[model samples]
Target: MLKGNREQELIELAQKMIQAKSYSGEEKQAAETIGEFCKANGFDDVIYDRYGNVIGIIKGNRPGPKVLFDGHIDTVPVSDESKWTQKPFAGEIVDGKLYGRGTSDMKGAVSAFTAAAKYFAEDTNRDFAGEILIAGVVHEECFEGIAAREISKNFKPDYVIIGEASQLNVKIGQRGRGEIVVETFGKPAHSANPEKGINAVYKMSKVINAIRDLVPTEHPVLGKGILELTDIKSAPYPGASVVPEYCRATYDRRLLVGETKESVIAPIRELLDKLMAEDSELKAKVSYAVGEEMCYTGNKIEGERFFPGWLYDQDEAWVQAVVKELNNAGFNPEITQYNFCTNGSHYAGEAGIKTLGIGPSRENLAHTVDEYIEIEQLTKVCECYYGVMKALLV
Candidate 1:
């Protein structure tokens, strides 16, 4: 068990991080807090990127592999504030649970990693083998895997510790995700002369039905690929007497390990191809988000299908190091994979870094109203983080 004062400090830090409202695209305050903590704790270096990612480094007296503690400080937007028992940013601690918007989705992990880094630094005079880095990234929810992509270009590490809620267990892999868009076009005509005009909406309805019956692809770890229709829009203003000329639909697709962007988009593209065969006016395309922003519209179209799925062998040395430390900390750690996507994909997939997911809290509680994390569990995570750092360093 953690000492009483250590537990209190852990809770206090979790609350502090929770109190800072670091919603996506507005992570400056939380980034500042992390930077300040790193500076005050005597980190060798603390830096922030233009995208508001906060990175703190603690170099070991001896040199070896570079291990990174990765987490996202940004959170999903909170709605229905009235539904929460405490203010989302108040950082309330009730009945041993720290409650706030970012509590479970990940501020707790950020705090845990920060405290663990401090612990390692305090014992820095001891002999160690590697460098430890704590990275609080931004724009995770808005743009998946973008944070680590940027980090890899600069501070590439041998191993990445993704600080997502895994009940302090070790996560070996996760499925990939992609965004898809399908559009239909037709000639517009007055409603009174409906027979003279092809209704794009009606044509799109057929494709939507077809997709509804499409089964998800299966994977060994990630379970299955899923397709969800997220957005739909029609061209031209809705009028009582006008047939729609264009219709567009957007889908969010979760990809498994064996699944590729082409595989996910092929079925839908095939649907559009079938439509095009019958009517040359119908058209569709599949794409992902780019790193572009417009001031007025904030329209970020799909950029590239670069986010890939990856896995770290649980028996690898780095993973064994993590398991040994976790076991020493009284956790019978289990090997698992995150059901959702994370920056780990970028490190392990794009950058070829050995990355594993480990943090506190139940994965299901993330991104929900009344989000909270167990103070006891967080304390354990701090110890776990400390042990992992010490094991790698020494």
Candidate 2:
């Protein structure tokens, strides 16, 4: 239903969004731009929530199922700007691809969704009976699913469409993520008298080594659960002459289906217990990491860094509808799953909502230097989004 010249308009909007710096907790500018676009393009109700999430609503005359198209506006900070061949914020185009920080990770897909929603609003011939909500959420890159969880408190939809980079495939599920902190405690003493104090770093090193050899459970679709050491730090102000009193190592664990927080942490706790029994002085504890962040609106948001994994059966009505829509839009969409976590972890994972993903660009391209999205893929994604709206709402 999206006709001529609209494709260019969508690209322009994506360019504008990419031009803005929306790193993690700072998405106010991108949210405002998206809100203005929604209002200018005939969205029925456009408003910003207390946490700075922008939601555009289009209500129908009759009662029907509520459908949400969700996309996060925030992106990870650009590391090593000198590594990028193109300007990270310029929204440059080369060889039919648009280059920028958020192009593939997601601003391009968000723009496509906005364009499709505008098209649906402008057309007088089609009368949809269900409500359509397009949300440009915030803080997803820093804290996955926190903003989405907040949004669901107000707008709980029957179905959700996540606009994460899927290479235009239909993603039915993803592995969950958990941030775990392994802390080792010891007494501080002079560095020269090492035997007087237990070295917490040495105890932490053993735990890290043990975790590296862990064989996580594997699923047929979601693949294997993985544990990787992401960060390590020791306390005591850099330790000039004193032995470090505390050492903490952060582990990122990918959870398979049926793996709960308790189940995920059981192995690490067992390892700690074994080590403590071997040496009473080695005091180590394992606990889930807690995250605290402030939104651009100055609202404080906090949650445990545990995202449950989720999956929807291919035979489900929503999955079938998305498949039909993608085919109708002239795309050969393969059924797939996300390798990384997204807001789906909250919507479908925690809330048990029926959810699927379809968007432009490859999933692997996210967070890489010189990130870009193909223009053709962007246009196709717009058509696919419109097709989905028609399949579910009309």
Give the top-scoring candidate (TM-score): 2
In candidate 1, which residue pairs clash?
128-393, 129-393, 288-302, 288-303, 289-302, 289-303, 290-303
Q: What TM-score quantifies how close candidate 2 is to the native fold?
A: 0.96
Candidate 1 weakest ten by summed lDDT: 293-302
Model 1 spans > 4 angstroms off: 124-126, 212-215, 289-306
Cα lDDT of model 1 by residue, 1-394, tens digit: 6677666776777888888887777777888888988898788899876566789998877778888998998899887899988789999888988899989889999999888887767766635777888998887876667766767778878878888999988899987777777777877899999888888888788778877987777776667677899998887766468898888888777776656667777887776677678766555555554454221113332236446777777888878987997787778989988888898778876677888888899988998889998888788888888878866667
Note the Cα lDDT for every prediction shown. 0.79, 0.88
Question: What are the per-residue Cα lDDT tens digits for candidate 2 across 84-190?
Answer: 99999999999999999999989999999988888875673437788889999998887788889878889889889999988888999999999999999988899
Give the lowest summed-lDDT range of ten residues in model 2. 120-129
